[model samples]
Target: MNFQKNKDEVFQAVANATEEAHRPQNSVKIIAVTKYVDSSIAKDLLKTGIEHIGENRVDKFLEKYEALADLKLTWHLIGSLQRRKVKDIINYLDYFHALDSVKLAAEIQKRANKPIKCFLQVNVSKEESKHGFMVEDIHQAIETIKNYDKIELVGLMTMAPFGADADQLKDIFSKTHALQKELQQLGIANMPFTELSMGMSGDFKEAIANGSTFVRIGTAFFK
Candidate 1:
């Protein structure tokens, strides 16, 4: 299928990007950003040995997820999850990215029927437009996580400010890694903060260097 071919090229690119970054110990898992991209393509990509496909909206993800239950795919809620929509997002999706606040995290924990995996979105760049918890609020979020039962805080994820100068990209990704270390050391029971999900189509190489375990690529893979 054409999607397999696309997935191969994307995987090869991931390997090449991983090698190019020269962080052999650090592996980067790619979540084919399938928002607005149909389920047929998602299935094709899955057939090509992909397990993760990210969806940016709660409603659309639920609709598509229900339609494709036969396929073994991990749906990622990769958009800003509103508190009101938490109940909706918890139904079908398990792995998630944009948990912007402790309140949202708590709502996810309450609504989740199973032990869902989540990444704390960090605003490393401290940009006003980005959807994430501030660095200072990390511990508070962790504390909030202790109150919830149905979800596990797996790691952290972030997107740098758009048009970030190459020179400033490292600073952003590195801050994410540094925060990951700090959070990991806190020893949040079963919630082991391991994955650092930062990087997009452009600065993925730099994101790898700073220790990104997952990279959400849309244009890079789909184009």
Candidate 2:
């Protein structure tokens, strides 16, 4: 695959979406999700100027992390992390996107040597298969999360159900964005809540229109 051509096309889409949303240029960052590809492809992707890399599985994340140790990259763990595995990779991440529960936050607090930037995962679509705090439950979760000194709530992350229609995508992403604003207004010390990790390869345009700050793209880059 021609990485540069793919990169240009994806970035142009990002630019178009950002412009349509009336958001400032460069306000959104793309995270190249490398969960399916090997470390070698990830390295080639980075040469296209993608500084952020994401992986869904702990084993794969560690494999890529070790392989890419020679390069400067911002690692993001974008999947639900098992508590028992926290000690293995908590310290290695620059951002943890699936901070779904207070229990997970506590585990990170116990295992991480320093503060870890985290995005509170919210199941805005309310899909039974998705892992995240319910929209109603986030306030309580934040109350409990405030005490985890090792965790910094930088933003909110969400996954709209696959195959959702445009209207469905709009509703889900709009709700997620609204909720993020609500949390930002709380002015909590540990939660700056300035970012929104919404959108994947398919629905990123709708996500960007609704104020997504980090769009995680995987298959688009690989294609």
Candidate 3:
């Protein structure tokens, strides 16, 4: 596969979408979801100017972390993190995109040797298969976790249901963006709430239109 060509195409698409949406080109951060590929491919992505990479599983995350330790890449843990596994991976993560519960937050607070940026995951689509706080409970969840000193609440993360149509995806992303704004107004200490991490390969254009600051892409880049 022509990785550089694919990377250029994705960047161009991101630029077009941002322009159409009237958002600044620099506003969106494209995170290469490296879960589907091994460290060898991930290293190639770094050489192609991809600075952010995400992995969902702890085992694979660690394996790649060791293999690619020489590189200066930002690591994102973008999966449902089990509390028991937090200790194994917390120190290595630069951004934790699946902080769904106060229980998990507490564990991270107790375990992390340094402050970790985190996105509170919200189940905006209310899909039974997703792991996150329900839309209605996000406010309470935020309030509960605000006291965690080691976790820096930087933004919110969510996933639109697989195969959802454009309108559905837009609606989900719109509501999540609204929630991010609402939380920003709360002025909670240590909670910047400046990011909305939504969108994937299939519907990132819709997400960019609705104010997604970070788009996690895997399939489009790997192919």
Candidate 4:
């Protein structure tokens, strides 16, 4: 699998989804997950018009960040974060995609120096292998998180069930979007949930069509 070929495929997927969605005002953002690869691949992706990449581990991210600090990049945390690592992530990361627990959220709120953006990871798929706050627990977690002045709840993020078709993916993405709306109606309007971080290299186009602003691309960028 050629990396460049895969990148082209992901780029096309994003563009096609954007055109199909017909939301002329909004463009989809693809955060390429550059996990464990090198900075050269990141630079290649940047050259191909990708400006953001997610890293699962802080240590690995730092290794790539050191070389990429000079380049314009947005680092997103797409991994389950431990309490001890919150301070370190707070020091570097601009956005975290997996704030799945309220306990962890509190720690992040305390450690966050600036107004850091966040995505509440919801277990829409309800899978044991995945890490996220169950759908039923999300509202209470969001309510608790709303009090933190340092963290801004941007939207909901979800990892769809494996082997899911396009239709299933759309439903999950739409569900995440609806969750955002429910939160807004509950007087959480000051910080509107504008993003639905769902989808990946596999079913991202469908997620986009139904409404997904941030797509965490992994295998597509890492081929």
Which candidate number maximizes lDDT?
2
* Candidate achieving the largest TM-score: 2
lDDT of 3 by residue, 65-160 (tens): 999998889999998899999999999999999998889999999999999999999998888888899978887887878888898999999999
lDDT, candidate 1, 28-109, per-residue tens? 8888787757877666666677778788988778877877788887778888888998886677776888878877877876
- Local distance difference test values of all predictions, in order: 0.80, 0.94, 0.91, 0.80
Instruction: Estimate the TM-score for candidate 4.
Output: 0.90
**lDDT at 2 for candidate 3?**
82
**Clash statistics: count for each candidate:** 0, 0, 0, 0
Minimum summed lDDT over a 10-residue window in model 4 is located at 183-192
Give the distance in Å from residue 210's predicted Cα in candidate 2 to where it truly belongs. Answer: 0.5
Flag the better candidate by TM-score, 3 or 4. Answer: 3
Q: Please, what is the TM-score per model? A: 0.91, 0.98, 0.97, 0.90
For model 2, how does the per-residue alpha-carbon lDDT over 1-223 read when each residue is reduced to its tens digit? Answer: 9999999999999999999999999999999999888999889987888889999999999999999998889999999999999999999999999998889988999999999999999998888999999999999988989988999999999998879999999999999999999999999998999999999999999999999999999999988
Candidate 2 or 1, higher TM-score: 2
Ranking by TM-score: 2, 3, 1, 4
- How would the candidate models be sorted by lDDT, starting from the highest? 2, 3, 1, 4
**Model 4 C-alpha lDDT per residue in residues 1-223, reported as the tens digit of each score:** 3666777787777887889888643478888888846778667776676778788887877788888877888888888889898887676887888888888878987888887788888888788998998888876777788888877888888888989876778778788778877776676743577777888888887788767888888876665
C-alpha positional error of residue 49 in candidate 2 after TM-score superposition, expressed in Å: 1.1
